[model samples]
Target: MRFLETDEHDDPILSVVNLVDLFLVVIAVLMIVIVSNPLNPFSDKSVVVIENPGQADMRMLVKDGEELREYESSGEIGEGEGIKAGVAYRLADGRMVYVPEAPAGGASGGAASADGAAQ
Candidate 1:
């Protein structure tokens, strides 16, 4: 009579199956979180993350077209191909206002404006 009373809860294999199922659920949740992030590697839009922003010797991580590059600041200005097309002023309210420099050429000014905001 006592042997006949053993039921589903008495099976040790069921406990192992439950543990595996819990692990699978946790793994699925982690995968979803990783893919949904804005800066995820699988995302299409490129992202640039600045390390120690506003510091002269900071570093940068640039992602473009599935490629990644790291740039470190040397605390000195570097030569680059671009025009200074705007001046940004931080207002009292902690907001920035960018005033576009006068157009020097036909398309150069437009390109600078588009890229300046990214910095």
Candidate 2:
């Protein structure tokens, strides 16, 4: 039949089908990006994201459970209510080590060094 022999390129429905396929590919890619994002709302895992690290205009986004919180720095050294719980010192090789203070009454029995030796 002549219809069977006609050029498919002249058919408008073929173009629509191709357009739909292109849209489907675009939608799939967008979904993948959204799902892979650490801040996705549907995800249950807690996530912390820092922006502009070490810069004055730094910001932080913390996501816990279903809640999200944002913090912006004022570019000054942070001063807050917190107690000194540990000490850190740089070694000769430039590596830093931390030593936590023993709890009151020596609840931990003794302080352990980085090499697990009692101090």
Candidate 3:
């Protein structure tokens, strides 16, 4: 067991493990920086961005378009409001579905023959 740990104080394998650990930490920190940046592809200020990806700290950012609205970190359960556009159902063929938004009772009126067929 001791040999596996290190043959001496300056073991090359041990140094490699330490270097790998350092690199891992650096990668983790870089990931955090990228996610926190506003220009990041996955950065969403409106919705909650988990503080540490998985470790939620009850902190959130509310964005309105390009505007950076606010940050809430009360560390308490919160609720938000938004207009529900529509629903979606997925097929069994590994495809996605997205139902479009429409006004209430709009289906019949929208398809009632715009050319005035009844006339």
Which model scores highest in TM-score?
2
Which lDDT tens digits does candidate 3 get at residues 11-98? 6888999999999999999999998776465644444343443344444555545555445455557689978876555557754455
How many clashes show up in model 2? 0
Point out the higher-scoring one by TM-score: 1 or 2. 2
Candidate 1: tens digits of C-alpha lDDT, residues 1-119: 88779799789999999999999999999999999875688887888888898798799988886888899988887688988867877767766667667675555343123235533
CA lDDT of each prediction against the hidden true structure: 0.78, 0.86, 0.59
Name the lDDT of candidate 2: 0.86
Q: What is the lDDT of candidate 1?
A: 0.78
Model 1: per-residue Cα lDDT at residue 109: 43
After superposing candidate 1 on the true structure, give the runs of residues whose Cα lies further than 4 Å from its correct spot. Answer: 77-119
- Candidate 3 lDDT at 94 equals 52
Tell me the TM-score of model 2. 0.74
